[model samples]
Target: MPEKQRLTPTVYVSVDIEADGPIPGPYSMVSLGAVTAGWHDADGFRRADGKQGFYRELRPISEQWDPQALAVSGLDRTALLRDGTDPAAAMRAFTDWVERLRTGPDGRRYRPVMVGYPAPYDWLFLSWYLVRFTGGSPFGHSGCLDVKTLYAARAGVPLASVGKRSMARGLLPDLPHTHHALDDAREQAVLFANVWEWDGVSRSG
Candidate 1:
């Protein structure tokens, strides 16, 4: 008889991005943050005891930026221009951090999965920068997990109707929605862990 194969755990990293415009390339991913929310395998879910993460602020790749977008994050573009890390350096550090997380202390490899609130927006900027500066994306093209979609599917609700406001109060994390990149990332990390452990039914139901 053939032996059963063991499955590798999936390490969920919650990601958030603060950009100067709606898209990448023409705009820029001004700041980004990622927190290791948890890991899951056959044994089920386990949340991280403490926030394990990475954050970087990058010098703008282009001068073009949407003022409205900057205002949303409350980050000063002028300050970033003067103090942000070089794009290449920031991407390199991010890559290294991701690699470390994927390779656990026991030397076994876990699949690194990027989780985000909406995902599309953050994934676009992070993927673009990773490819542009690091030659490839660590999360790859399909490794993203959108919390919004997860909630919609679990709650049996339409995607359009699954905003945070629509979620049950108990399902929501207590963290504040600070626009600061790292702060938001940590908040999203808590939300992701909660959603992951949910039994696909509302607590009140």
Candidate 2:
């Protein structure tokens, strides 16, 4: 008989970020949050039993920012400048958190996968800062999952038609969509877990 391939355990970490502009460098990721949403392997998937999260507000790296982008997050740039954590320190702390998650009690290492609602926006800022400040990213170059795209694929619909409003009610998380980084991260955690376990027909049909 042929040997069965062992599936690697993957830890899904839901992440959210509030930025002062559309991209990194010229802009800045002002606030960011991440939560261990769940883990999956050959056995099955399970959601986090309790909240395991990390959050940080960072000082702007550049003075240039879009006024509208700042308004969307409703964070005071002046206050962040004075009180926010340093970018290097913040990225280090975030990296440490991810490392902790990757180390298992049984000594088996798990892959840490980053999950975000839309993903690209958050990944752009996160990857840039991690590489810039920490010299590397814990998620590496490709350890990201987009919940929106997952839902779109599972539902067999065009990505553009997969907004919350267009999704099935059962697949939606009950959490509020607050712009606060931690709150949104927690919300996304639940949403990611829901989508991970979904086995449903396409709503488009």
Candidate 3:
């Protein structure tokens, strides 16, 4: 029989999006950001646990822009219109970056899971964007991991109390602010690391 692959909890990409409503789709994704982190080997090759990756923003689709969402994210539509890169280009760039992380600077192949605090909320916009503009999902179906759920389970807390502020105060203790996707993603990563390292258990598993 083939060797069973151990669940090496590494290579995570955290995505966050500010959308117009509880759900994405016609509501529109106003802004998006992501951060990838893990461990790297001596050659700068991302080992399964390499703490190396990217954080970036993508311009919202002009025709599908949501005023209500913009109000919440505070991203300037006028500026985006004038200077934002195209959504398709942004998505392509993001995917290319992900590939670089998984492979090597020279190009190789590796697997990384996309992670988020509330996975579904962020994934909705990211998945929608990839499908709409990036041709296909580079992260794939097994790509997503929900740190919110994991933390709740590990700390014996309710999911209702697992938002950014809640997690920061309870688990992180030092994380400040919310709504900024990259910051939030980093906070969740730190929280996940704490739970996984100190507590010594796969919270999600």
Candidate 4:
């Protein structure tokens, strides 16, 4: 690939998931949320406008559950069991939604990259579900961009030392971190934008 093409603009897809336990097969991803953060080009980051978001609650696949993990999301396991979207159908729809966001208004095909506060956990469930149900991932296997790691590198701090509270006020969004999947996904999109564009200046004023 040419240098220019390799550096082509990106469509950042922020993703969040709420699960019943630590792992996938033994547990379940109760809910999932995803949204476009925006286009990032030479100008800067601009949050996506009028782009639809994706959210789905899925029925549990196994009998194992952790009380603390279940409590955090507050999603009704019983309700999900009764009326949640099927995992295979939901994964297919999620991939389709992601594919739709790849084309820009000017006809440019942007690379769709998954953005997460801390990519591993979300990526774990998301990748597993995508590969398991849809047989592939729209963002590919290694396309996730971790906001936490991004901040740590840009801030010249140890990765473990970085936290949202430690970031510059301006680089952090005003949105609350409600544990709801969609709300947190939107909030995370804004956060990835801010951190990605920050100029290494700590802006508290």
Candidate 5:
């Protein structure tokens, strides 16, 4: 019998986006950030050392914006209008970054999977922007892994009940929730790895 080839390892890319409103088109994704959380194979999940990342502040395509949403990121729209990368250029760079991740820094070929906390909100914006600007997404039309849903299933809890506050402390690193896209993505990468490795059994008495 011939030997079988091993499946490509799964690489998790944690992503976070800061937007100017509720949705794309009428609004804008002011900033996009991402990092290679880790990879899983026959040896199991291993964290990325000196993780690779991508971040860009985008020029707004529409004038519409929500004050509360903009306030959360604390990013100035005026400054972005003046200096941010063009949306199309930014998306192209993002696509290139994702392609690079297919060959990890460790020299192993990997299958990159887009990961988001709850997923829907971030995914919606990312997908729309990628298609609108770059014409396609590196992760495909519907490819994504939701961290919140992953934990919910692992912990045997309701989807609506999962939140960082309810998660085990050790599962989350002592990183600040800066609301900055890159900072948040880095923190999320660690969280994704920790949760992925957790047994999900409650250790409480």
Candidate 6:
């Protein structure tokens, strides 16, 4: 990559997870997904390639898997059994992949931020899961950016006003179906891009 093509400091890991309900510890994480992006992708705000990192899926802990949550995510125990990787292994792989992006090929540290639509909800489950599985988050629990809060703040409105339906109607080309973790994460990313474009976000430093 050329000097101008070098990656920026602002990297985003947009995440989503399906659960039994609002509560964190008691409820369980059913399915989790995340897409990585960078500040250059901020709605054509500047010159940047907006390169994509990668997506990850982790195996759920047997005790943490909930039947009701499976109903919501439509993912059966059989599927998880066959496809999921162990939680600790998954976290190690995920953090390793993340570190690669945050650092240069030669190994410089990068502190890419994490982003989520309804942040605290997803982060609560993820943080707990990471701590339980790995003892701590590699990102150090810093920079948990909330898209809903960003939308609310930019629109000068409350969260209720920026409801998914309203946001889909006003900004997105289509509404995202909830419960599907990967799809939801992608939809939130799209929504964020659209909002950034509309709001004319200039600098994301």
- Candidate 3's C-alpha runs over 4 A off are 1-10, 20-23, 39-56, 62-66, 104-109, 161-170, 200-205
Output the TM-score of candidate 2: 0.93
Instruction: List runs of model 2 lying over 4 Å from the truth.
Output: 1-5, 105-107, 202-205
lDDT of 1 by residue, 1-205 (tens): 3232566678888899999998999999889888888887665678885368798888899989999998888888898899999999999999899889987544667888899999999999999999999899878878999999998887788999988888866778777898988889989988887877777865625
Give the Cα lDDT of each candidate: 0.86, 0.88, 0.62, 0.86, 0.87, 0.63
TM-score of each: 0.94, 0.93, 0.73, 0.93, 0.93, 0.73
Superposed Cα deviation of residue 77, candidate 1 (Å): 1.1
lDDT of 5 by residue, 49-145 (tens): 5258899999999989998998999999999999999999999999998888888656888887889887899999999999999899988876799
Between prediction 2 and prediction 6, the one with superior lDDT is: 2
Better of 2 and 3 by lDDT: 2
Clashes of each: 0, 0, 7, 0, 0, 0
Error of 3 at 48 (Å): 10
Highest lDDT model number: 2
How well is each residue in 142-183 modelled by candidate 6, as lDDT tens digits?
668887877777766777777765553456636466767777
Q: Residue 67 in candidate 2 has what lDDT?
A: 84
The reply for model 4, stretches above 4 Å from the true place, is 1-6, 42-44, 49-51, 202-205
Off by over 4 Å in 6: 1-8, 20-25, 40-58, 62-66, 103-110, 168-170, 173-178, 200-205
- All candidates: CA RMSD (Å): 2.2, 2.3, 5.2, 2.0, 2.5, 6.0
Error of 5 at 102 (Å): 0.4
lDDT string for model 3 (121-159, tens) is 788778878878877877886688787777777667788
User: 94-166, model 2: which lDDT tens digit per residue?
Assistant: 9999999996544667899999999999999999999999899989899999999999888878999889888
